[model samples]
Target: MTTPPFDPPSEADIATVSAQLGRPARNVLGIAARCVCGAPTVVATAPRLDDGTPFPTLYYLSHPAATAAMSDLEATQVMPVLQDLLATDETVRDAYRLAHETYLADREGIAVVPEIEGISAGGMPVRVKCLHALAAHSLAAGPGVNPIGDLALAQGDWSPLVCQCVDYNKDRASAGQ
Candidate 1:
């Protein structure tokens, strides 16, 4: 299939697509909760104490309601808005910061649990998982001037697999587990 032309996305466009898809204006707290606790499985594991341990990871759909709400036409219409968000410097920076913060929080929270194994550092694992999630979301959502690609590229080999895991987990969650 031929790739469509890339254009900047706008908030108005996002709203339009969201409306057509019946996207609800859920609160951030709700969104965060869905992200953390709604998934079928939530676990933190490590092979050894010194080894880097994966923290309490929960995966959920980035846009749960909208995923089902959006038709192909609506998604196509919203593509420009998504692209614009990806292309803007501020948006890119903000997204990275959010992902980074999420990672740090996950790491810190997992570190105190004591049940998890293989944890040498909490920060890096969190960052890795966050990046993986972001990349997976981007790829599934479709590519158009993605800013998160930088972080995914930095990790290279692992990013794709992590993204795949993110996708898998999200799918599993949406399936009602």
Candidate 2:
């Protein structure tokens, strides 16, 4: 596999990306957590949109070592790259691929799987789905959204039901229930 440019982001860049994306500080911190944990995948606590739509804001998959090696400065520097990655389909795929490879390399013997568990509210089992499909559907259904739809699909094998679950969560969050 071709090793992509492996530069991490800088702190300022991280702030820039966070501001540009309108993501919360905790989500940014989650990215740092993934880097520090050296795990195959790191999921950010979903963020709410300005209108209070709960959705998977970002997903970082990479070798724990590569992530761990990333300094705060590097993470900042990498923000633009990540923004670009999310902006284009090809770059998103590249980013996912690179992260997956890095994650595998970091955890050689570990078996990591992406999952979505149902959240309970009002005594109802609120189903949840993978973030990738929801992102794809959003990109396709709405114009001017980021072009990370395909990138989301490329990361794993997700089902429509899973996508529906994600959508439900987003809707619930938007509804403020």
Candidate 3:
């Protein structure tokens, strides 16, 4: 596996991610993607968390706006639609399979957990289980890498190109709970 394409997290990044998550961001390896406001939007976490559990979600969406957007998309019952696309569109299936492979490679580059090997977040390769994970992967890898993720993101009301973060400088309401 090659080196993961992400920057090491800074103290501010850790703090921002913690605030976005409303809890301590444990075992965060790096900042995968950032919002337009420069706040951490996606984080790269350890394959195995500190407690030795096999946590396979390597790219975690942290920004409240992005998280909310993904939640809204999920609430719309889009997973089944995308899953159908995967079942019929060979091109989409091929790309999604590649996304799963890329996700695994990125995780293995950092650390490999035997229990989670061959598993990628958001039900990649075969299903569209979590928009949050898929969106996080899309943001971290950039567009065209994760087609389903990109499609889900396109369906969202929020945009990373514009800062939709809610009061990053002050305590505020979190969308989509």
Candidate 4:
């Protein structure tokens, strides 16, 4: 809490993240995690945006491959299965609840937003809404923090150890963005 537990993002990082997300990176406080190829994977965003918006997704998945993998899992309806696991497994539920608490603590360590005080992203401690958010947290905070996130990353076909980034700049240049 004394110092943020992540690398401060540079201008090139912002540019690369923008390209990864196919839009401008908004209020990214730092790079939470990086791929093996040194590309941004998880981005740490501000608890609040410049426009007074309460943004709760602190650790955001920026890598296209990672996002696509999470999307694929959602498309395959894996949320229900994970939700059931959360409902049935007491240990996992307890860990998930703890993860939610830690997430709130981490965010509040920066600044407390009354509007999003108890709310954690990815339907944490209750539901399995977004695998991307959960996976991002796991990737950033490392293993054993978020149970659902660990499970999701285990089930997903993507690997952070390998870089799956495509040159979005080249794609945009060829298509004239």
Candidate 5:
């Protein structure tokens, strides 16, 4: 597999990702996607977390604005429509399946966990469960890999190209590292 399309996270990147998540960022292998302003938008997490829990979601959405936008789409019931499209459109289904395989390959390239074998995030290759995860995957992998992620992002009110970051440093809340 090609190298995971991400850079190893810096100290500041990890801290900012922690702040954006409102909790300590855990087991982040790399900065998957960043806001144009340089804050972490998505993080590449280890398949097995520090606590040894199996994490199927390799790309975790961290930016508050991006997450909020995806939440808005979910609130508006976009998942069912996307799910319907997956069911009816063979081309979409095929692309989604390829996306699942790609996700699995990427994650397994890092480290394999028997529990999450063949499983990918956001109900990929089958359903549309979490727009946050799907969008994160899209942002991390870039366009054309995940059609559902691309569609969710297109249907949402956010863009990675734009900067909508809040002053995370001002916040005092943290779930502890």
Candidate 6:
């Protein structure tokens, strides 16, 4: 496989991401996708952290709005519906398998961890576990790659085509984070 190009994150990007996540961003390799407002929506992380933790979630959702949207979808019990779609529809299942393959390729392109070799986040190729992880992959890899992710994104309130990020710095200033 050819080595994919990567854009390394800057110090400022790290700081902003830390603020966005309300904690330190660990082993972030690059910004996977950005919002219309220029803030990061998804981040590509290293397969292994500094402490040797094997984190399989390569594309991490960073935007608060997107996270909230996923949370809302999860609250509405959308995973079972999506899981049923995968179970009943061959085309959707095939596409989801492909998405899983693509996700594995992207993660392996960064670094391969033995424990997480066959595992992709968001219960790929089988179940709908985390909409956030799937949606992050959809945002990073674009539409048609992950059908479930795309569907979830379509069903959700937020859209990457439009900016929905809050003014984090301003909010922090007022709340004293």
CA lDDT scores, all candidates in order: 0.34, 0.33, 0.90, 0.90, 0.88, 0.90
Q: Compose the digit string of candidate 6's lDDT tens values, residues 16-50.
A: 79988999999998998998877888989888999
- For each candidate in turn, the TM-score is 0.26, 0.22, 0.93, 0.93, 0.92, 0.93
**Any idea how many clashes model 5 has?**
0
lDDT of 4 by residue, 3-24 (tens): 3599999999999999888899
Where does model 5 exceed 4 Å of error? 1-3, 166-177
Which number leads on lDDT?
A: 4
Q: Backbone collision count in every prediction? A: 5, 18, 0, 0, 0, 0
How many Å off is the CA of 42 in candidate 1?
11
Candidate 4 C-alpha error for residue 132, in Å: 0.5
| Runs with alpha carbons beyond 4 Å of true place in candidate 2 | 1-6, 27-128, 131-177
Q: Which TM-score value belongs to model 5?
A: 0.92
For candidate 3, the 10 contiguous residues with the lowest summed lDDT are 168-177
Candidate 5: give the clashing pairs: none
Could you report the Cα RMSD, in angstroms, for every candidate shown?
16.8, 18.1, 2.4, 2.0, 3.3, 1.8
Cα lDDT tens digits, model 5, 1-177, are: 355879899999998888778688899999988899888899999999888899999999998878889999999987889999999999999999999999999998898899999899999879888899999999999999999999999989898988877533333235332
Clashing pairs in 3: none
Score residue 177 of candidate 5 by CA lDDT: 26
Clashing pairs in 4: none
User: Total clashes, candidate 6?
Assistant: 0
Between prediction 4 and prediction 5, which has the larger TM-score? Answer: 4
lDDT string, candidate 1, 1-177, tens digits = 211122222454344334322463221111221123232111122112344443333222243322332233233444344445545667675654554454434444434435543232212222222333444333332343224534343334323222233564477679875
